[model samples]
Target: MQTANNCNFRSSALGPAPLPYHPHHPGLPLALPAPVAAAPALPVPVPVAPVAPLAALPTPPPPPPPPATIVQTLTRHVPVPVLVPKPFPVPVEKLVHVDRPVPVEVPVPRPYPVAYPVEKFIKVDRPYPVHVAVPVPRPYPVPVAIRAHYEPLHHHHHRHHYLHHHHDW
Candidate 1:
């Protein structure tokens, strides 16, 4: 009895235990793996020639009828006044020649006055002699054989300049 109680307690802890395996099931159908289907085939294209537009038909000619004729009568009437050329009066002055030639007095025009003779006197201007004191070109003192050499003059000039400058504070 203790063993049966222990089994029952273990079965209750596992929650009613799993159902026993059966040969036939009545609750649900067995699950099947999903079926893979192939893609559908594409339609084949048909080749066709382009159709041309039809040309327009020519127009029918018009029917002909009868020709027409006209008659006219001509009449003439004379004008009362006919245009005649009339004579012109002759000029007595233009036809006859005169004994004394027609006096044409043409007045003689006076000549233009002669220009006055101009007496031009040239006034002589006495030019005051500008006494420009042109500095007489003094020819450089020609060095002679008897003259002293430049060395002495250069020494003398240096000594003079030194003596003059020495006195300045």
Candidate 2:
């Protein structure tokens, strides 16, 4: 804590060098702070009455808005179709057939199939019913050859319905 002015300035050309105990000098071991005297008590200001808080008028209905704005409200979810006029327009003598669309559901016949495939045309050999003429051998074969000319040959031969030549075997 001793000041440079208190030391003998004979050898050092440098101006007033800080002592190691000086608080602002660098590279010196830190020393505990000197104990300070207790602070004096300060006087607190008195709380004002808050100037009576101005009276707060009723807010004047927001000053009637800068300009008028239209506010529309939606009421109906769906508009129903009206069929006949409110209370029968015609007299009792006149007959009227009328009904509201909302109350009644008119039945309409759906379309019948004009042209539709009953089954798929696959690449299959579909079966078909047909009468088949099969070649069946007779129980006992009997030659049904009718002879045109029943001429008795040199000996005898089978009765055929065709002309026979002598060279025919």
Candidate 3:
């Protein structure tokens, strides 16, 4: 008799009882002797074609006479209005030009031979020139819409939520 961790292996009838089934143990099917490599599959013999059956089809029938057709007439009527002739009512008034004279106002010229102040552009020299800044552009996403100010008239009533424990008293 041999002993292993509370299990007994006796040198008698039942040979070791095959250990308790572990996948890593040497008692699996792969540990048995392999089949003879299957004899190289024998090449699978070539198949023969199928033969025709012994039955045949039936024959066709004779000609049918020309079918008789009855005539039918469907009519729909609609009324159209006819127009009448009349004279046109246009009033014609003949107009002609009337001739008369009225007095007119014209400005007298300032007889000097020089350009007016409004027509002259002059550049004056100074130490400090007034700076008008050109704003530097920044890369930002352009807004597509400008929303109007709006407020809802009636507000919904909502209760304040509280977590319940019952022992929080």
C-alpha lDDT score of every prediction, in listed order: 0.24, 0.28, 0.25
Model 1 regions more than 4 Å off: 1-37, 54-169
Q: Could you give candidate 2's per-residue lDDT for residues 129-161 as a string of tens digits? A: 111111213331232211111122233233221
lDDT of 2: 0.28
Give the per-residue lDDT of model 1 (tens digit) for 1-169. Answer: 2255333233355556434333255233345446987887798888989765454545576767553221121122111111112221222233222232211111111121111112211111212111111111133122211111112111111221111122111
* Residue pairs in clash, model 2: none
Model 1: which residue pairs collide? Answer: none
Q: Give the clash count for each candidate.
A: 0, 0, 0
Q: Name the best candidate (by lDDT).
A: 2
Model 2 lowest lDDT segment of ten: 122-131
Q: What local lDDT does model 1 show for residue 87?
A: 26
Candidate 2: which stretches are off by over 4 Å? Answer: 1-34, 47-51, 54-61, 66-169
Clash count (model 1, backbone only): 0
Top candidate, metric TM-score:
2
Residue-level lDDT of model 3, residues 35-109, one tens digit each, is: 677556667778979765554444455678664342121122111111211221111111111121111111111
lDDT of 3 at 95: 10
